[model samples]
Target chain A: MLFVPGNNPGMLLNADVYGADALILDLEDAVAPAEKDAARVLVRNALSACGYQGCEIIVRINPLGSGYTGEDISAIVPLRPDMLMPTKVSDAGAIREVSRMMAEAERESGLAEGTVGLLPLIETAAGVERAYEIAAADPRVKAIFLGAEDLSSDLQAIRSKPGGEIAYARGRMVMAARAAGVDVYDTPFTDVNDEEGLRQDAELARALGFTGKAVISPRHVEAVNQAFTPGEGEIRYAREVMDAIEEGKRLGRGAVSLRGKMIDKPIVDRALRVLETARALGLGGAEHE
Target chain B: MSKLVEGIAEAVRRSGLKDGMTVSFHHHLRNGDYVLNMVLEEAARQGIRGLTVQASSLFDAHLPLIDHMKSGVVTGLETDYMSGGIGREISRGVLGQPVIFRSHGGRPEAIESGRVHIDVAFIAAPAADPLGNANGVAGPAACGSLGYAMSDAKCADTVVLVTDHIEEYPLIPASIGEEDVDIVARVDSIGDPGGIVSGTTRITRDPVGLAIARYAAQVIEASGLCREGFSFQTGAGGASLAVTQYLKPIMKRLGVTGSFGLGGITGYMVDMLEEGYFRSLLDVQCFDLRAVQSIRDNPRHFEVSATRYAGPHAKSAAVDSLDVVVLGATEIDTDFNVNVHTDSNGYIIGGSGGHSDTAAGAKLAMIVAPLYRARLPIVVDRVLTRSTPGKTVDVLVTQRGIAVNPLRGDLEEKLRAFGLPVVDIHELKERAERVTGKPETVRPGGRVVARVEYRDGSIIDEIRSTEE
Candidate 1:
């Protein structure tokens, strides 16, 4: 995903050409306080006027108490964006309020109820603790995102490049979202110039079981996508494992062995998931072969 | 037999520059050149009138020529390229005769064929001996590869060498020797070193530019010509130069060794030559300080004259051997005709320095540009000026998609087989129109302001004066 400034028409017009799976039209932090109302209208009209190629458009509305969320939600909900990411979200009540507002707007606009999904941003320390409740607050909550910059300031910790300060929060948020059966996203690596550092950070997030990572720069999109995709060797081995399973089933055998190693249920499931993700990304798959 | 004159005034007097004669100058010094202004000032002081200025290229530093045109000192203009400073005045019908615009190759061809007679040629040498032997690789205003001036030295009736640095008896390895020079004049300074060569030529950081470059590189790779002994040329524009940068890794991965890198050389091309990605560099001009240094120190970085570079009348030129060339455009019509001479507003901003020559010579000629700039589509229904005809152009690569010329069906099939986004040229124009609504065509009115001459000595297009 890429975060495009909501107020910049140039960036907004070109947001989808960068090959990002999702575009976050940011109106919370990128737009100034003085231009909040104007940026909301600009983003709403942009959604109506322009085609984001095929990217899933997510509008990042202001927090619940910012005095602008009500208008942002009302103006953009009628556009039927793919999702709405509410910033600085703390507890289940915040999620419920935004969900209720979305439902009301959907009904008034003649869209089916829960037409737009909700992505709760867990930034504060209290939000990290109650992440599960927020993720499970309503059926509209599709995913929970980690905003480490605000969470570090809330904890009064020094931010480092290796991101030791956010380790606990990352683990806790991932576990919470997993327990609630919702997808989780990691924070954006802020350094636009450091591709090596971004690679390492994205690898760490993937290892920690985050479904995807957001990027603040378009240059980082390719590197992040590369780090998250399964490699050629992995894809080849997954195809072999599936072939072995098929052969075993034809022979009526109880177990399948590939290269002197037994392919168990968990291994089969992991292989299937890898092939599924690779197929979704339009890579070389068994179907193509 | 010293051949050394006191100053430009003496040189102008000794050359017998008549009132209606044509004098020429090279653009090695680019925007920092003072020799053009100084010589024209002396000619004006000498009460010369109706003189035609034949320069290889003009820059913003040559804005004084506009004043000379107004004062009747200069009545005619001929150049391969003109920057916006002087071009704006020309577009407003300042000169009595229309400016004759030619490709870098066509300029030398016209000079050699005697179709465009030169009465005098002023060569700006950074370092020269009293015997009129000079080189561009020394002194304070050291601009490497004095390639454009070599033609003027050989064919002009009178050749005057102007230099700020006077060397000892014999300047070894002189780019322009004493045999061709008539008078050697000493000046305080030829040009500012800062503007002669750029300090650094950095790759583009714009994502849109990079995306276009990436697609162009892919097109080159898919052309099936990127094998052993690949020869390439690209301009100094950010996106054009970035294509060279992107091709570096592809060449490495494929173990492809290019025969030569051509055109106005940049530091990135120097690096590629030094790294063995290319066996050598054929430079007609140095665009940066690194290129100047490399041309001075490395034997592999050889300099060639403008005629040898791309002159259509020459027996053969380096452009004939080129596999690919990447160019930029202000506007490209659906037919692939490119207009680099005028902007969308019908204002003269650039010209075809090597655009037409290389497009005619290269096997695959690709144009890299964004689909739209500032809400104006780059692919228009028709261009304001046709600097390069559509038949020679092969591909148009934009961030949205790549459009191959319908004439090259084989290339279109190759790009499609590689899974590259190959769209019809008309569809590409439509894609741009969908984003930016159809723009009103700009039809410049009034008398003709410039005549765009192709490399083959035919008038391809005529640019009319812009109405205020």
Candidate 2:
């Protein structure tokens, strides 16, 4: 859902309506090399002027040392967007560089320190290897997203439909995120018309323990969100399990059974996590996920 | 003995538009019409406050009403349609009171029944005599139909005519005759004639729009309604009008001729009539120049009063037999309640217009819009405002899928059997959400500014004030 091109004002204006929990106004990849300067200016103006129908605003700048990333950061940092996503981030050095520039810009612009967070797109083999270190590099490095297209291209392998080729890298990214105590986003599904494909990919990414999936089209948002969020049956089971486990514990029993399934500690823990995930997904009460 | 006055202020004084009273205006001149703004400005200058405006419709040209609302010169609004300028501000909660929406026929019926009393009525005349006989056809700003203003002239306590041209006494062929007038105030120009009718009424070529139009036609065809002598109505929106275009081929293929095309007549509908698709066009409001000339020239192209069009009080209005109406929506909830009143951000960019009325009366009421606009999902948990009831809404046609209300099991069965992309409302909501993520629910702040009045005059939903 976060694919508003920096050059397109109409896209930027409508970015909120598509309900991308966060909108990444793209300053790189989406803009042509010749139109980079114009796109930067338009994105800057839109950031300062247009109100995003309540979606979290994130601006994805071009890679560091690309000559445009510096300008993009300098132009957008003053507006204090929720986050800045620097594409093709290979190591902690690139993150540190962005952090320094953002700090300098934040100070110069009179914004509070540490107001802007960083979302580094881990695309290279080197970045995937250094995921945990890069995520733990800066306090502002809130989330690490796996750029599957770039990573797959770097690995010189064709992407499998069910994500077999990207599985190792995705698993490593997820573990690294957990180790670093930060969120990790899966790569965006590219085929806009393929809803089933998007849904399967999102479900696979969610199963692999990614926090959220990246979105190329606004159409991909719902699938990713739903895949990441627990559903009604799961929520009901989690609630009942939690309630039963709580009752057993109150009665001084070490374990309990519901529907002939062993209600062990790990199962209880998983149920708690499920309920927590549901609550965080904005699903409230015992009704349903 | 003549009713001609010096200015709007003089006319306001004559009509007794005091603090805390209701005044009315018509939108036949549409976006080009200047009388509403002129009269409201005069009212604001007169230090009038807490006044309600009962307009037949509002256009983008009435942006000045925001200031009037802000300054408390005008607080409430009652209208059938609104075209975004004042609407966006109102949705952001600019008005202290909510704008009541009535149908085209309901507006007049409300006035006549004393449900809504107008202290003064301002008619934007193209030409009016000193004695206050006015007609739209005989002036520089001819808008073709003054149907919306007729009832206001009859029911308002005092009636004021604001026109640019001053004809001699007893203007001939008066659409609004002299007997209803108390005063006439001449202005330099009522408004730009070109700006009166909308320009977006053309059949949309956008493939998404075309796909939706195609599906809507198929739904109508599958509903077992598109036979010979079938009747229909649609709004002046690009997508809605596109349904008119796509339906032509289907109607031609089926060799089915329609009875009449109703509501705000457009050139597209006129073309359909001329092409032998429909027998006649019953226009309450002419939307384009071709329609205007057609009404003036063609015997088959006729002008109908608002009462005869969609009046709830009528024995049977034109909407009663409406086979289908393809309308657009800002949002539609899981329950099938549709909101045309506000955008996804809860900004009032539109009003009910004929949305609820046609839905109530039409055999098939299809809410046609993209599943998601911009990045905002059109299908939601609950609409921001319920302009039309769920039971009245039969089908929702979007580029993504078509949702038939559970109330219409037959519609669902028919659409599914025809191999249409029939999905449940909940499934459509999920389909929309699966792509656009769940939008942060927009909650209007703690104030009720307006109530959506169903065609039966019952409060269907309340629009809350928002500071957005």
Q: Which ten residues in a row have the lowest lDDT in candidate 1 chain A?
A: A280-289
* DockQ score of each predicted structure, in the order shown: 0.54, 0.02
TM-scores of the models, in the order given = 0.96, 0.62
Clashing pairs in 1: none
User: How does model 2 score by TM-score?
Assistant: 0.62
Q: Interface RMSD (C-alpha) of each candidate?
A: 1.6, 10.8
Candidate that would win on lDDT: 1
lDDT of 2 by residue, A9-104 (tens): 666644664446888899999899999999998888778766664677889999977888778888999988989999888889989989999999
